[model samples]
Target chain A: METMLRKREDKIAIIGAGTIGLSFAALHLLKHPTCSIAIYDTRPDVHDYVAEYMSKTLAGAGVDIDSTMQRLRISAYLQEAVLDAVIVQEQGPENLDFKITTWAEIERYAPKTALFWSSTSGIPASQQSRNMQDKTRLLVVHPYNPPHIMPLLEVVPSPRTSQAVIDETLEYWRGIGRTPVVIKKECTGFVANRLAFALFREACSLVTQGVIDVKDLDEVVQNSMGPRWTVAGPFKSYHAGGGDGGLKSFLNKIGGTVQQCWDASEKDVKKGSIAVGEDWQIEVCRQTDEAYGVVDTRERDTRTRSVLEAVSCEEEVQ
Target chain B: METMLRKREDKIAIIGAGTIGLSFAALHLLKHPTCSIAIYDTRPDVHDYVAEYMSKTLAGAGVDIDSTMQRLRISAYLQEAVLDAVIVQEQGPENLDFKITTWAEIERYAPKTALFWSSTSGIPASQQSRNMQDKTRLLVVHPYNPPHIMPLLEVVPSPRTSQAVIDETLEYWRGIGRTPVVIKKECTGFVANRLAFALFREACSLVTQGVIDVKDLDEVVQNSMGPRWTVAGPFKSYHAGGGDGGLKSFLNKIGGTVQQCWDASEKDVKKGSIAVGEDWQIEVCRQTDEAYGVVDTRERDTRTRSVLEAVSCEEEVQ
Candidate 1:
C-alpha cells in the first residue's frame, strides 16, 4: 500500500466519493489546504473520477486547487488510505455488515490513534463500533445532503468514545469552516434527521388525512416558520410566541394548549406506509415531479462554484 | 354599537387584542408612520393595558409612536373600533363557536365591505363562515408569530369563499409589506402550522424515543437545512443535490433512499408522552432552555419593524 506523496499535516482519509464525501473532500482541499487528503473507495473508478471532476469543478469555479489536487491521491487499497491519515472519514455503504467489515479493516490498517468518523444517518455509533477492538475512536460525523453548502455536521459518540476524539474532530470540522454539533451520547439518527423526519411525518400525515395539499403545505412552511427556522430553532421560535419573557412565558400562557395539542397529535399521526391516495395527492406528486424536472443542478453547482470564487475566504468564515 | 369618528389619516382598528392581535397592532403602528392602529378587545382591561405597555415599549425602543399613540384608541366596543377603518385585522379565538359569535357581532356594527381578515391558525374559512350571509366577504389570513418580523402569511379561502376575497385579503396584507401565499383550499391548521407541526411531531417522537437530544437536534437544523431553507424550499434544496441535471436525477437516484428512509421513519417515532431519564437528556433540556431564553425578541422585533419601514410603499403599486 503506497501512500500519496504529500507531507502529513492533519492527514485525512476520505473512505468514499459520494455526494457528501466528495463535497467534504473539495471543501477540505480548498479550506484546509495544509491538510493531506487521500480518498479511498472499493469502486476502482470512483477515486479517479471524483478527483478529476473536482479539479475541473474547482478550476471552473475559479478556485485555486491545482496544488491541492496534486496532493489528493486516491487509494484503491485500504492500507494506503490508513497509512499516515490521522482522521478517517467513512462514507461507505449504509449496510451494517459493510460497516462492521470497514471497522475491522480500519483497525487492521489505520494508525492506532486515528479517529473513525462514519457518515451514517440512522445507525448509531454504539451499534457500529460494538465489534471493534478500540471502539473509543469510532463516532458518527453525519452531514446533511451537500456537506459543503450546508454547514452542519452531527458528531454522535458512543459512551465509550473518547473526549480527545470529539475535541479533535470538532477542531478539524471548524478548521474547514463547517459547523459541527457534538451529540453528548450515541442515539439513533443522531439529531438532524430525527428533527427533519419528525417534520416530514407530520407533513405526510396531514396530506394523508386531506388537511392541506402538498403545494400549499410546502408554501406554508417556506413562507412562515421556515424562514424563522432559518435564523433560529424551534425553541427560539416558541420563545417568541411567549412574548417579552420568552419561552417560559410562552409555555406558561400556551404550554397547556400545546401539551393538550401534543396529546391529541398522537392519534392523528396514522403510521405505517406512505399513504398515497386522492386526486390532490397524485397532483402533488405530479407537480413536484414537473417542477423538479425543470431544475438544473449543473447550473446550481456552477453558481455555487462561482459564488464561492467571487467571495473572499474570510467572508465565509461565519 | 356606536361608531367612533376617524381621528386621523393613520387610524386603523385591530380587533381581539390578544397575543396575535397586539403583536400585529404594535408592529403595524411601529413600522408604518402612515397609520395609527386602535386595538379593541372584549376584555376592557387587556385592551387598555396592552395599548399602554406597548406604547411605552415602542417609545423605549426609539420608535416615536407619540403621534400614532395620540390616534391609538382602546375600545371595548366592536362598533367603536370598526368605524371609519380602511381595513379590519381580526385575531379572534380559533374556536368556531367564539369566532362565529364575534363575526356576527362585528357584522352588525361594521360597514358591509370593510376588508375583514381573520388570524386563525386553525378552523377553515368555510366553517367560520358557514352561518354568515355574506361568506365571500371574509377570508382566513394567518401569520407566523411576531408577525412584525415574519413576512409570510397564508391567505386561505373556503370552498365558497370568493377569489375576490382572496385577492383583496392579499392586497391588504401586501399593503402592510407581508409575503402572502394564497391557499385555495381550507384545511386544518392552514399551511405553515400543518407542515411545521408535522416536523414538530416527528421531532418530538425522535426526542421521546431517545434518538437525539433536543439541543443537538436544533443545532444540526439551525446550521444546516435552516440556512438553505431561508433561501429555498426542500425541492430546490434537492434540485441542487442532484448535481448535474437537477431534481430529476435526485428523485431517480436518491429518491428511493429518501422513500426507504421515510418508510422506516414511521416505526421509529415514539407515540405519546416524553420521558427524559438520562443525565445527558437533562443536560440537553437545560441547554435548550438556556439557548431559547437568551434570544432577545425586542431586538428581533426592531429588525422586523425596520425592514417593514424600509420597504417602499410605492413599489407595492407597481
Candidate 2:
C-alpha cells in the first residue's frame, strides 16, 4: 500500500481547471510520470473535464494513460487539495480579486515548504501576494499560450521573492524540459507578450495604412522573420547580419537606417517606434548581459540557421 | 551544341556578384538546373568567389557540381550579360544613385520584355524605378536575407509597374521555391523589416528599463514568439487565441487589454504604440481581406499549432 501511493513530497496541487490549468496538469502528468496531481476547481464538471481532456490528448504522446489518469485526483475542497502540496500552481481566472483571495486562502492550507506559482499572464506576483504569509515563494510562472505545447515558461518574481525560491523555480522548470527565463523586474505584459504586442501594433498599422493587407503581412512574416527568429533572437540575427564585425558592426551600419525607418513609420502611423540610436541599439545588442544563457553570435550555430535550412529544405521536398 | 549553350530566353542575368548577387546566382543555379546563369560584376575575384561558394554549398545539396558550374557564366561587362536575358536580378549597392544609374543602363541592353528585379531591402520600387525608360517591369523583389537560403521574397511593385509584370514577378519567384508576397505600395523598410524593427524597439525598451536583460529577452523570444511566428503569423496566432470566437472574439476581449498594456509601456518608454481601439482592431483582425492568401482562423489549423507541437516534441526528444 505504501508503494502504491505516491510520496508525500510528490503531491502537486493545481487550483482552477480552465484551459491553462488543464494544460499545466497534463504537462506535469505527462512529463513527470512519478508525481501525483490534485486539481481543485469550483466548476461542477471538473472531473468530467479532466477525463475528457486526458482522453483526447493521452493517445498522442507515449505517456501512460491509465497510470497518469490514476495519479490525478480531483477535489471540490481547496484545503483538501492543497493540504500537503509540495508545489501549488494556480491557474485561476485573470481577475486580481479572485487571485488575492485565493492566494490568501492557499497560504493557510498549503505546507510551509510549498512554492506558490501563478499562471497569470498579466497580473504580477506582487499583486497576488497581498495577504499571503510567505511571499518569498510566490511568483508568476507564465506560459506562452497552451503550456503543454509551448516551450517558454517566463519565471517572473516579485520584488519580495527570495533568491532561493527563484533558484528553486528555475530548477523545477529546467527539470521538466521547459526553457525558463528569469525576468529581472515585473513589468506589464512581462517580456514575450510585450515584444509580440509591439510587433503586432506595427502589423496593424501596415495593414490599415494600405502598405499591405493583413493576409499578405502574415504571409511575409511566415516566410521571413518567422523562420529567422525561431532559431536566433533579434540580437543574434543582427549580429550575424553584420558579417564579421558582429552586432556592433550591424548597429554602426544600420542603426541610423533603423531609426529612419521608425521615423517614417511614426510619420505615417500612430504606432510608436523605439529609439534605434547607436546608444539604445548598443544597449540591447550586448551578448553578455548576464541572462539565463548566451549563444555566441559569431558561431552562428543557432536554431535560426537550422530552422531556416530545414524550412527551405522542406520547400525543396515539396 | 544548342543544348550545351542553353536557350536564349533561359538566360537569367544576375547583376553585381556581391554577397547577395552571388547568393542569387547560387539559388538560380541550384534550384533551376535547366536555366543558364550569367553573372556580371566589376570585382576582379568574381570567378574565384563563385567557385569557392559553389564548392562549399554544392556538395551539401544534391545539385550536380559540374552541371551547375557548366550553366554558369561570369562576365565583366553588364551589357554582354543582360543582352539576351529574360530576367535580370540586380543585387547592387544600396545606393539610390547607384540603382538609378544601373537600372537606366540595364534598360538599354536587356530585352524590353525582361522583368527587372532590384534586391533592395529598403529603397522602394517607386524610388528605384527612376531614370529607367521601362519602369513597368522594374520593381523591388527583395529577399529576407541570404537570398539562397531564406524563403521570403518581397515583390514590391512601383505605382507605374504593369499588372502583367507583377504577375510575371510572382510567377518567376514561385517557379523557383520562394514565397513572394506582393506589397501594394512602397513604404520605407517595406513590410518585414518594419514589423521586425517595431518588435526590436520594444525589446530595447524592456532591456533599457531593466524589466528583462538582453540575454533573457532573447531567450524568452527564441522560445515563445520565435517558434510561434515561424508557424503562423500574428493574426492567425491571435485568432486561435480567441478560441471559437476567432479574430473578432480575440479583439473584443483582449484588444482593450492590449491597448492598456501599450499605454503602460508608453508611460515608461517613448517607443511608439499603435491604436487598439475596437475599430482599428477590426480593420487588421480581418482574415479574409484581399491579399495573396488567407488562412481560415476559424479552423485554428494554422502553422502555429504544428510549430508549437514540433518545438515541444523536440524538447521531449532532447
Candidate 3:
C-alpha cells in the first residue's frame, strides 16, 4: 500500500556469491551507491572471493571502488544476510529443489513484507517457491549474464504474487537503472530467452545446413540484426520499414515471406543439430575473447553503459 | 583474380532510385568518397526525388554533402546508367518479372566483367537472373533497412555465381566499410530475415499469448539481447557464458531449457496469428518515433554510425 519507490537506505541482501550474484552485487553497488548490501554464500571463503572479485570486475568496469566497497557487507550466514533486508535477491543454482530450499530459508529469515527476488532464468517462481510459506513475497527477477553491463531484468511473478510486491519490484529495478519487464504469465525461458533461442535455433540450423559457416553467421548477426535490434525491436524495425505507412504496410508486403521462412526453419532443435562441433566451439570462444575480452572489459562495458545512459536520457527527455 | 580490392574510382550504377537504392547510394558515397555513381529509375521525377532524398538523409546521417553530390550522377537512360559500371547494384521492386526485365537491360548494356548486385531481400539471384544471358555476374547484396547506418550486407551468390564475383563482392563491401556475410546457399529470406522472422514469430506469439505487451517486449530485447548481440552473436555469447569450459559447458547446463523454449515458440507464422491489432501497431510506431524519431534522424543515424565505428575499431585492434 506504501509508495512503490525504493528508498536510498534500503538494505538489500544477495544470496550465493557466484558469477550471477557477484555481477548483480557490482551493478547494485555501482547504480545504487547509497543503498546497503549484504552478500551470503555457503562457501567458506566466499567473503574473500567476493571482495577480490568485486575489486577486479568493478574497477575494470569503471566503478568507484572505494564507495562500492564501503557499502558492501559479506556474511557466511543466511539469516545474518536476510534478517533486516527490505529486498533479498537469491542467485542460487538452477535446481528446483535447491531454489525451493533457498526460498524457504529466505522466507524464514526475511520479514513477511520483504521482497524475495530470484535470478533463475528458466525456473518459474511458482515452482521455486512451492515449499515457501508465503509465495506472495517471492518472484523471479532474472537478469542476463554480466548483469552489470546488460540492463534487462525479467520480473516474473507467480499466480499468488501480491500486486504490491510486483509494483515494488518493478519500481525497485527501475530505480537501480534496470529495464524490467513483468512477465504476465510464468513461461519457460521467459521472453528474452524465448526470442533469443528462437533466433539461435535458426542460426544453428543454418550452420548445420551449410547455408553459412559459424563465424560468418556470427558476422551476419553482429553486423545486421544485432545493431538494428539494439536501436529498435522487430516490430519497431518493421514499422520503420513500412516507410510512412507503418507496421500495417510493412507486414502486408513481407508477411508471406516471413511465413515461408518460418516454414523453412528447422523443426526439431535436437542436441546434435544445435551443436557447433568442439573445434567450432573452441574457435568461437577464442574469437569472442579476442574481440570483447573476458567478462566486463572497459571497452565493452563502457559501450553498453553509454548506450543504456543514452536510452534512459532519451526516455527522460521524451 | 586481379586483386579483389575495389578502387575508389570504380564506376557504380544504381538502378531504381527508391528507398533501398537511395540508402545504398548514400552509404556508398559516404564511405567511398571517390566512387562515381549513376542512378536510373523509370519514374519521371526520380532524379529530383532521389537528389532531395539523398541530400536530406545523407546530411542528417552526418555525411559530407558536397563530395556525395559531386560523385553522384542521375540518368534516365538504362544504357547511360550501366555503360561503364564496374558494379551495377539493382534495387528494383521485389517483382520477379520486374527484376528479370531490369537485369536483362543491365546485362545488355554493362560489360561482361561488371559485377551485378541486387538488393532483393527475398528473391534469389538465380530466379531474377533466369532471363539473363550471364548469371555469373549477378548476385544478391541485401542490406538491412537504412543501409547507410546498418553495417550488415548479406552477400548471397547463386550456384552459378562465379568465385571471382563472390570474392570481389566481399572485398568491395569491406572497402566501403560494410560487413558482408556470404550466404552459401540460396534460401528464401536469406540469413538475416530468416533469423529476424524466427525471433519475430516468438515475439508475436508472446504478445498474442498475453505474456507481455508490445512495448514491454521491445524494451526487454533492446535492453538485454540487443546490446549483448551487438557485441557478440548467440554462439559467441553462449561461448562466453560457458566461462572456462566454453560453449560445451554452457550447453551441458542449459541446453534442455533452450530446447523447451524452442518447442514453445509458435510453429506457424500465419498472417492472422502473427498480427498484433491495428491499434497496437500504431501505438508501437508512435512510441518508436518518440524514442528514435522518424526514419533517419541525425541522432539515431549518428548513434548507429558511432557503434559501427567502435566495433570496427575493436576488430582492428584485436
TM-score of each candidate structure, all chains considered together: 0.80, 0.83, 0.89
**Backbone clashes in model 2, listed as residue pairs:** A231-A303, A231-A304, A272-B272, A272-B273, A273-B272
In model 1, pairs of residues that clash are A198-B202, A198-B203, A199-B199, A202-B198, A242-A250, B10-B36
State the lDDT of candidate 3 residue by residue for B215-290, as single tens digits: 7888888888787777778877786687766666777678788767765674423422554343334544455455
On the 0 to 100 scale, the lDDT of residue A266 in model 3 is: 47
Fnat of every candidate, listed in order: 0.35, 0.53, 0.61
How far is B145's C-alpha from truth in model 3 (Å)?
A: 1.4
What C-alpha root-mean-square deviation, in Å, does candidate 3 show against the real structure?
4.0
> Comparing 2 and 3 by DockQ, which wins?
3
- Per candidate, chain B TM-score? 0.82, 0.80, 0.88
Best-matching candidate per lDDT: 3
Q: What global local distance difference test value does model 2 have?
A: 0.73
**Fraction of native Cα-Cα interface contacts (under 8 Å, chains A and B) also present in model 3:** 0.61
The deviation in Å at residue B99 for candidate 1 is 2.8
- Which lDDT tens digits does candidate 2 get at residues A138-177? 9999998778767789999999999988888887777877
CAPRI verdict on model 3? acceptable
Candidate 3: where are CA atoms >4 Å away?
A1-9, A61-67, A266-303, A306-318, B1-9, B61-67, B266-299, B313-318
For candidate 3, what is the TM-score?
0.89
Candidate that would win on TM-score:
3
